[model samples]
Target: MKDKKSAKLNLQHKQHQNGHLSPSTFAKLLDLEASWDKDQLGDVLHWIRQIVALICGLLWGAVPLVGGIWLVAFLLISSGIVYGYYAIILKVDEEEFGGHGSLLQEGLFASVTLFLLAWTLVYSLAHF
Candidate 1:
């Protein structure tokens, strides 16, 4: 019985370790948005953060022109970070926009995917 319990506990711990953030931790992150009053500036800031990943996609396209590979790399990493911040914004959007949190997540995912794709295209096109 003891061994079985230990094994079960270990498995549960492993599952959480594998990128499985708990709702409490995720909810704590979302708390940041709660401080903002549902108003114009708060909405503006939310939009800006949500668009960071999209901005990275645009930045990656310009990398080839000026040899801004480092800059582009920085933008890509920053975009990922901003997407995380936007996740918090999304939670707030749930309250403000009637549970449309996935919209921001989708935008971030799409923008990150396109950013990487654009970078890959630039490399292949320039080389080939």
Candidate 2:
């Protein structure tokens, strides 16, 4: 009986280790993060979004286009990626992320920055 009990307990422990995150640990981590400054979170998200935008811009720029038409696609795709990640994956509230205005601004800023960088690279490569 003692061996059976110990074996059952060991099995339970192993199951816990192999299974999904414990609710208590997940809740505790969320509680710890909740104490963080909202602005800091927004800033971090903003920068990450910008980097995504830049990457999208570079990829879009790689395709040949006669005009600035690629920019529209870049803006849409980059913003979608950032918004999806934050709103769906992270479950971040708009209030914590500095509202829609900030989000749009960040997306625009990133798109423009990336556009400029891509343009410069392409121009240099073409001329040289």
Candidate 3:
């Protein structure tokens, strides 16, 4: 009986490990930021936006003519979404140190610089 119970517990743990949670999407849809008591939302937004920007930078290189416009639009839309989610949905107020503007600015700067640097490197490599 003890061995059977241990096996059952192990099976439950394995099932939990393999659970299809996808909690990020669920949190977004439900605006579950209220669960966090601190002001780390801005930081989270910053990192998320920066990652998205990096992906956009990578995609920027593979597009044809007038690709910059598309990239700019995507960046704007994504940033807007981030802002709306944090300010409206999450109800996160403006913090003194890492406020929404600061986070957005930092993220946009990093992403744009990354995109430019990547583009420059690729251009140089292709030309040389």
Clashing pairs in 3: none
Please give the distance, in angstroms, between residue 16's alpha carbon in candidate 3 and its true position after superposition: 28
Name the candidate that leads on TM-score: 2
lDDT of 3 by residue, 1-128 (tens): 99999999999865764423335534654464445423245446656666676666555554431446766776786688677766677675658445766646645666667766665565455555
Residue 113's lDDT in candidate 3: 73
What is the alpha-carbon lDDT of model 2 when measured against the actual structure? 0.59
Q: For candidate 2, which ten residues in a row score worst on lDDT?
A: 28-37
How far out, in Å, is residue 30 in model 3? 7.1
The regions of model 1 sitting more than 4 angstroms off are: 32-59, 62-66, 69-118, 122-128
Candidate 1 lDDT by residue in tens digits, 1-128: 99999999999976764433434444544465434333322343334444564455455555553455654664556545544554545444444533334333334444546556665666567655
Q: How does candidate 1 fare on TM-score?
A: 0.33
lDDT of 2 by residue, 31-104 (tens): 43444244344444566566766665455545444356666766676677667655665566777657866755
